[model samples]
Target: MSDEGEMTGGEDRPLDWANEPHMSSVDTIMWRGDTDRRMRGTICMLEIYDCSPDWDRLVAAHEWGSRMAPRFRQRVVDSPLGAGTPSWAVDPDFDLHYHLRRIKLGGDGSMRELLVTCEQLAMTALDAARPPWEGTLIEGLPDGKAAYFLKAHHALTDGLGAIIGLAQLHSPTREHNPGKPQPPSPDPVNIGPLDLIGRQIGDEIGRIPHRVDLALKGVRALTNPRKALSSALRYGRSVPRVAGLVSPPGSPLLAHRSLSWRFSAFEVPFTDLKAAATAVNASINDIYLAGLIGGFRIYHEKMGSPVDTIPVAIPISVRRPEDPAGGNRIAVGRLAGPVGIADPFERVLTIREQVRLARHEPAVDIFNTLGSVMAWLPGTMLMQFSGAASQNDLQASNVPGIPWDTYVAGAKVERMFPFGPLPGCAMMATMITHNGTACLGINSDGAAVTDLELFAECLIAGFGEVLALAADDGVEPGVLRRVE
Candidate 1:
């Protein structure tokens, strides 16, 4: 078939040939209009990098998106789906421009203008008719570097999935193709309340036998009250230890969050942070938070508002092998990082211990389950309240990376930095390792972190100090260095 003919046929087909969970399950999970307005599924963030290609090249590169099937590539659309499915599902009627937008920000644009543009771009609502994904060719990056801002709903992909998608769109080595067949148009994605209810009914029916078995098992276990009590005690004991890492409400260190967002970025040589982790027997995440604690120390100290403690909420991934990879599969864990501890090693050690202990807490699962339950509320309600409550200080996430080579548009991805949302807090720091470099993306509240450049400088300095301490403790200087 001709290229246009193939594209036309693909767009007409129902996405049934692709993966279809019960339509109800998808409806429940997709981000709904209510949630979109309040919390808005605008959870994803993007960083524009300087590439050597012209505008036409970038647009042509994306045409590959429409040639694939829904299973291969589809955007999510919302319908009056029920609670069982996600609110976002594959959009069969995929329109190229709906996902790709062009914006020029030159005439008198400043750095602030770029940020405002990004935020506004973030706010531009996704078309419920097509899939919930977008790519904007962002020109006018400072220093003449053209950029692209690609965003998808949080319901579509998490950190890992986003990285993977970017990798697929790129190639390890450069090969300029004049043109390629377009990817298939996606199938229709819709979920209504009836779909949710039906899926729940099916789930209940399937679980009857297992639930019965679980009930009998529970009864037997309850008969052995001593064992159960012992297990409970063991679990309870693990909480207070990690309490420093995840302070519950009422902790003095939890800072106030505002409505605005601020952003800054820092690059730490992977070799350095890895050495620090080795010295302290901490993971890269532990050191990442340590660096954050160090930065917060500077931030609060400059404000003359330093506190002895601050609670950080760390989102922990809880996806099991059997779980689907697409949707949210993570949980949050609160830990108190020692901001007051002047000594870097002491702070790292404290974080290490608390994080270690937190692994055993039953409450961690309870909190995660609570988030899942809350996700079921009307999207509008969930967005409004979740943001309202979460506007507290600091969100730190550590997403694993592909240890091997990965590419985008055939450009060798020299680095990957992650920029997470800054809700109500003063700052959000995210770390991702790309080609062995630890790229840190920090989005600060413009008002709260007034001097974005200075904050970025502090992060750079603090990382050096932490790395020095790690090296002093006998960490090999070259262990974590990037291969590139």
Candidate 2:
């Protein structure tokens, strides 16, 4: 699903009209990660209340918003000879209606039905020929309510970038008015295979000087015995740390995976979570990881195979202030969750300490640096590397979101659930805070995570255990709420 926002510095300024934007190295990796059966896409589900939005107004709003973000009207143009990274070219045949769809729920229009519909949409891969996004308006909910499901390719944006794009389509108040229609999008240029290869070769040749300069600097450093010794010492010390960044030994039960996916969602009160974190002297992220550990432990025990620990990949956002708003700037850090620890408080404390030390390790910097290089590799090699990187049991991420209540085209948005890609992992759990509540969306590989319903119940029970820990700190248990 996609939202509307411009690249940094593109707002209010006229389009270059001379050159198309180049996909970043990180984005290129995401693009290559997409396969025919398994598409790496991010789905955002927003439940709106009161009434359905006017179709015409919503379309116009999207049009206006897309004008601000030209990437919405562009498609990735890969180099014909695999000479360089892909480029973003304007899609001359871009159709607003094709990307924006409307569907009506049958019968009572229960939330379960809505989610099922969303699951189908999520499973269907986005068309690579056009822009990599589609927004669906789901109508016919109880009490005149409706929902919007926005699906965007992972190559287009990360979690934070998705939030920023969505903000452009919403308003602080219902009285806001959408402005006039914008000008037409630019036409795409047609470049033949020979031209594409020439352009790519030229680009690579242009980098020769920079490469030689770096090589000379490296030679100079090696000539200095003291500097070379220091560098060798640093490398030797970081060898183990770099190895630790890869997946650790995990439960064999969740080792097998399939292309199929199952999405589960639940809500927890933010205040209760904050209290629990405070009681343990940890961050909200620590509490989140702790809860997952507890849940996984319970799940394994129920399956008659309790494990000691599980490795989880945590995405660390490395976005800088000057980075554009709608591209990826994230690195993965693997952590061994102490699920063997029976005490919830003790588990949280252990996780907090582990995360604190992991962040400071030189391995994380090395991992990020390698990630940039991996993006330029062949798609098959990158996929192999990604498969190895995602060998961990689960991936947990916490993306900060809009704090205030928001409205989309005059409809009140009650909840926002973010569904991240499973990415060969057993499960991908992501949480976002919206309007005083922590909304968690869990996307599990259906083949690996059998009995998703029971797993969801276990997650709720896990959070209950954490909230119980917070009770000693004077936080009321009643503040915690669960939605399955």
- Candidate 2 C-alpha lDDT tens digits along 179-247: 323446556655566766676666668868977997898788887989888876876676454444444
**Candidate 1 deviant stretches above 4 angstroms:** 1-41, 45-54, 66-82, 87-89, 107-116, 141-144, 177-186, 189-196, 232-256, 321-323, 367-391, 402-407, 410-412, 423-425, 447-454, 473-484
Task: Report model 2's TM-score to 2 decimal places.
Answer: 0.89
Task: State the local distance difference test value for candidate 2.
Answer: 0.73
For every candidate, C-alpha RMSD to the true structure in Å: 5.9, 3.6
lDDT of each: 0.56, 0.73
Error of 1 at 377 (Å): 3.9
lDDT of 2 at 377: 75
What is the alpha-carbon RMSD of candidate 2 to the true structure? 3.6
lDDT of 2 at 62: 78
- Cα deviation in Å at residue 346, candidate 2? 1.4
lDDT of 1 by residue, 347-393 (tens): 88888777775554665554343443444566566546555445446
The CA lDDT at 202 in model 2 is 67
